[model samples]
Each structure stands twice: as structure tokens, then as C-alpha cells.
Target: MKKVLAAVLAGAMLTASMAGCSGTASSSSSSKAASDSKADSTAATSTASAEDEALTCTLNVWGPAEDQAKDKGNWLPTTCEQFKKLHPKWNITFKYSACSEGDAGKTVTQDPSAAGDVYFFANDQINTLISANALSELGGSTVDEIKSSCSKEIIDSVTVKDSVYGVPFTTNTWFMYYNKSKFSDTDVKSLDAMLKKGKVAFPISNSWYLPAFFIANGCTMYGDKGTDESAGIQFGGDKGTEVTKYLATLVANPNFKNDADGSGLAGLRDGSISAYFSGSWDAAAVKEALGSNFGAVSLPTVNIGGSEKQLKSFSGSKAIGVNPNTKNPQVAVALAKYLGGADAQRSHYKLRSIVPCNTEVLKDTDIQKDAMVTAQNETFEKTSIIQPFVASMKDFWTPTENFGKALISKEITKDNAASKVEALTKAYKNPVS
Candidate 1:
């Protein structure tokens, strides 16, 4: 049975512990026009008046727990407050957690029928849940509104059968970022120059390498064309082979190493490393890693036997989603709309330095003026979306995780990685394919 809603009153915001500066509660175009930087904003303005008159109306939310500590705006408490303030008649309770690589498959198995009103899911989980009907088809109400505010690309994995079930959440693209204090102007011009001549490190254990290299080498990591079955990462196919060779190239590079753990952020902070492949949000981490000495670029483009794409980074931005089980979906949808709008997304970005899905938010002079944001838009448009399937995190990502672990550990060699991926792909579709 679904739980009753309750007022989302006061939870200590853990924003101070997160990186980035505080946001100034102002979204004026003129105010934002001069600075290219967005600050982390958490001013206690109860703009959502609806929350005041609300009672026991709950909203179940599941997502990355890191946001709890690192982001002030996107998490359950903040978003719920914003939502409740708008619809004061409906009080909401939130369930939160951070599900990452190893823990991906374990939790969803516990309560499929009533997991939460909404969950922040990825590509690996989609197919598995589709057959089980554990997921509610987002259908008519809120999905398009989400698409309008956030982006359609953000929810690509959750789209199936010409219909969308999940609202856009998690930018979910993978690539590399660098610390410039460790590099120079000449170092970034080319891949060969940077790899053999500059300092670099990458988190080998993280599957970021697969999609990063696959795309850098001009190979398809996920399908680009929705209509073509073989176009995207469909279990096992050309993509797996491309992934194998791409890994081989990086391993062979003397400037790059397999033992590296975290895109050189730790090393940059410690003054031992200079550059590496990583996620977009790591820009803050990079600054934390090498304060006053950080500059990053898209991961270097490379040759996979001989295909070529530009360098890019891994991304994971989240959006608001509505639960199918909600008795008052109209209110939920309205709240979700407000949450994903420019005002809310911009505020959240100020709090977390997350790139906004609302294209207009990006236009805010403050955000658009940044050199990195300008450079990133190009990459974001072209790079691969490497998140796990959105249907079923348990069934899809676990096998993919095992495959990733195997690939990184050399248990699956470059020569055989393709075949292994094919096996995993078959396993992914399990009874269906």
C-alpha cells in the first residue's frame, strides 16, 4: 500500500559541505549577465505557498544519495519544499538513497510493486522493469513537460515502444575533464601531444573508459538512430569490439595508465597528476583537486583501428519524475513542471554547478558566458550517452557492471571483449531477446 503524505518541513541542509559558492536568490537576466559563473543558492524563500496549507500527502523519491551531501537544490528535501510551497494543500514525504555501480541491482529487488512514487533511473534498468510492469508508464501528464524543461536526450534510455515512462533525470553522458595547472596551452591541441607529452590519469575501474574511448574513436557506444535495432548499444555487436580496441589503445599509451583511479582529481589535488577522463560535474572536484590550477577539455579523440570522434566527458544530471501510483497526479505533474522550469533548474545549478537541461537556463548570461559551458555544449550534443538501460537497474546494469569489471581487470581481454559483451548482451535481453 502507498504511504500517506506528510509535510516536508525542516531538514538541515547539508549544502555547506558541498563544493561551490552559494546562490544569490536572484534570476534577473541583468544580474546574471556579467558573470559566467553560477553560485550555489539556498536562500529560504518559501515561494511555493501551496506547501503551507498542505497536510499528509507523500511523494516517494529514490535517487543518488551523494546529492544529499553535495547538492542543496536537486535532492528530496529541497525539491519537495519547492513543490509543497506551490501546492500547499499537498504535503509530501520523500525516500532517498544513492544507488551507484555495485549497488545498482541489489535494492530494486526488494519491493518492485511499491518501490517509490519516483526513482532516478538509468539505461541499464529499463528493459528489466518493462516486462515486470514495476514501472508506471509516465504517459500523458508530466513527461512532455519534463521534456520541455529539461531535455529529451536526458531520458533516451527510458523511452520504449514510442512512449516514455521516465521523466528526464541524470545527464548521464560519460567523458573526461582535466586540471590545467598540470597542463599547458600547447598540451591540449592534440591527442598525441597530450598523451605522450602531458600528465594524465583516468579511473580505470570505472566504466567511463568504455564509452569515452568508444566515442573518441568515432565508434557508437549507444545507438544514435532510434529506428535501427543495430544502431545503438544492443547487448552485443560492433560497439563491444570498438570498446575493446579503444581500451587497448589507452592501456598502451605510456602517458595513460590502468591503475589510475578517479580521473586524476585526487592526484591533481595532491600535486601528483595533471589530467584525465572524468564526469562533467568533476569541474568542482577538479578545482577542489587543484585549486587555482585547473583547466579541462573533452577526453582526447583517438583511433579505434580507424574511426574518429571528438573528445567528450561523462555526465549525470537528474530531473524530476512523477510516480504512476500517485492519487493526485495533476498536482504532482504541476509540481514537477515547476521543479524542472528555468527558475528551479537554475537555482539548483547555482547550488550544485550542474548543467541545466532547460536550454533557456543555459542562455542565462552567467551560465553561457563560461568558456567551459560554451565548449561543453558542442560535446554534449555529439558525445555518447553511456548510462545503463532505464528499464531495470537490477537486471541490466548488474551484468553490464560485471562486464565492465571484467573488461577493466583484464579478465576479458581486448581480443575477447567483444565476444564477452555479446554474451552479456544476450544475458541482458535474457528471456525477451
Candidate 2:
């Protein structure tokens, strides 16, 4: 068990500048950890003891299909082999499966006892996993390494109360992508400014994408940090109605189009829309669409009422987590930490272009130069809020979606914005879930 801890420390000792396409064997080290003779000696002794223990177990690990694909570098099995080498005592047989991070919480909770011993999940699912007793809390040197290797915001994504339940590997959020030929750098800074000069497409009807407007104008969900359920949704009152009116006017603009069914990307491809909002998952498509004119940036400010307010996206992380029900609790926990460790993240980035959340990995010159990484990190730090994961949040989606659909259909005009916003607020407070 401590052998995993030693491996983490050793990985932290490797130069943070190692940003190459090496597999898990070439895991990068963090400068944040103390590098001393005593620590190195202890690490060696721990490895020796772990070899003596010689534990053998069979465990199941789960992640997205891309990670398991040989064409994609087989990130899962490759990293697993590296972990096994660190704990030579553990004769681990890993059973691989394709369960994307987005579906991990639902799939696991459906039959947690039978789910993978180690798995990947979107950080917003932390509360749900905890509620089902599916996620195990991390502690000791593993917890210490995690804290030292990630940003506070990244750490907060997997934290419940004061305990961390998962190790985040990459950020999850959307930002702005525009056509450089259509908008100047200055013009791209403001959504309202950009709209006047070029066609803009937004997924206004998406429940996930709808809150950016409300949040920009003093509205809140759950609570300030998005963890307080009793605080309910503060999307009513003057501020909320003001945003509602602004959105109504926005949707009615001749240059604006509601992005639906990949219509935004489609429009970008045909030059029908010069700007769109999305995440790294669309980077290739956007790049292919715009060629040399491609541009990506953190979300821009939106004018609401009489003032300019910064538009924010819902932000979180995709993380590696261990099932609390795993028979091999120690090994499962170790593997979870190893998979999300800095080295694994660097490899994931090199092999799959997954934007890493590990602070040390983010410092590498190559990783620093990636346009999509910059956009995502900037949004995480400056233009996004944690998406709440409390059980009560389940009630938020449908109502918000219905509200956005109404806006798209022009059912809520400036005249009816107040009443409609109030009704939406009520629905949030008295959610069906």
C-alpha cells in the first residue's frame, strides 16, 4: 500500500519539464514535494517491503474507450503496467472495460457492488457517488500528493465537506471558439460586441449551457460555491429577470442562432456562423472548419442591463475514483491515484490531447503552448463556476431546459420575463427530484 505512496513521491521527484510523449514509465515529477535523502531512502525501503509482501489480486478498471484503444496508445493498460512495476509484490490482473467518465456515476450506482474496482467519473458526480457509498475517501501521502499537485479549484471539484474522494485528471468545461478572420482579438472579448459584427451560435437551449447568462448577472444555483442545497437557486428577483430580458433580446437578434443538434459546428464549417461556444472535444472540428482562421479563448463578457458582466461556464473535472465496495480496497485506491497522477495525465495529454488539470503538468512548455489547454485553464481560473453535485441539483436540469426552450420559442418576452423568471425560480425551489 505504501509502495503506491512511494511511487507517487518518486513521480513527484521527476522534472516537471518532462512533457514528451513517453508512456507512464516516464511519469513526470512535481517540484512541490521536498526532495531530500531521507525521503528517497524511505521510498526505497517501502518498495523493498512492498516486494516482500507480494500481494496478488484481480481488479477491474474502467475508463473511456479512447483510453483502451490501441490506436490511442492504450493509456489504461500501459499505465496499469507501470503501476504494477512499482508494487512488484502485487500480482494484479486488471480486467478492462469501456465506461466513459460521463456515465460512470449512473453505471456504478446501478450496481455498485459489481462495478469496476477503479473507475473514471466527471467530478460533478462526486456527491451522487458519495450518496450511494460508491466513492472511497483518499488519505495519507496520496492525499498530500494530490493537494500538492493540483490547483485549489481542481481539488475542490472532488472534495465533499473537507475530504477528497477522487483524484482529478483533467478539467471539464466549455469556452469560446471564433473565426479569427471575422473578429479581432479585442472584438472577441465581448459576446455583445462580437454579435454586432458577425453571426454567433450558442446552445441557448442546453441546460448545461444556459446558466452562464444567469450567473453573469448575480444569479446563483445551490449556493455561492454551488454546494449549498438549502440556498436553492437565486435565479429570481431583479437580477434574474434582468438577465431573462437580455436573453430574450439576444435570441431575437438577426445575427444570433440557437445551436442545436451540432448545428453550431455545422454553421461554423460553412461560414454561416463566425463564432461558437464549445470545449476541447470540438477542437479538431473547429480547427478543420476554420483552418488558419481558428481562434479559441475563455468566455467573453456579456452586457446585461446597463453594465458588462463576465460570462461564466459551468466548470469541473473528470477524475479517477475507487469503489468503496472493492474487495481490494488498498490496491484500488492506489490505482485510482496512479491513474490521475501527473505522469499519467501528461501521457493522456500526449496520446489523447486531454487537457490536464495537474498543476505541474500544466507548467511544461509544450503543454503551456497548446491553445485549447490555455483556453480551458483560463476558464477554470477566471470565467467558470463549480457545477453543483448535490442530490437536490437533479431537480435543476429539466426546469432549466424548459426555461431555455421557452426562450428559444419566444414564449418569454420582455413583457413576460418577470413572471416567467419567478415561475422558474419556484420550480427550482420546489424541484420534482
CA lDDT of each prediction against the hidden true structure: 0.50, 0.81
Best by lDDT: 2
Off by over 4 Å in 2: 1-46, 430-433
Write down the RMSD of all candidates, one decimal each. 11.9, 8.3
lDDT of 2 by residue, 1-433 (tens): 4435535655443222122212121221111111211123323224454345445578799889989999979989999999888887677898999999999879989987778878999998888887786777766566787899988888988887787778889999999999999999999899999989999999999999999999999898877877767788889899999999999999999999999999999999999999999997788779889999989999999999999999999999999987766655556666777898889999988888789888888999998987888999999889999888888787888999999999999999999999999999888764434
| lDDT comparing candidate 2 with the true structure | 0.81
TM-score for each predicted model, relative to the true structure: 0.68, 0.86
* Candidate 2 root-mean-square deviation in Å: 8.3
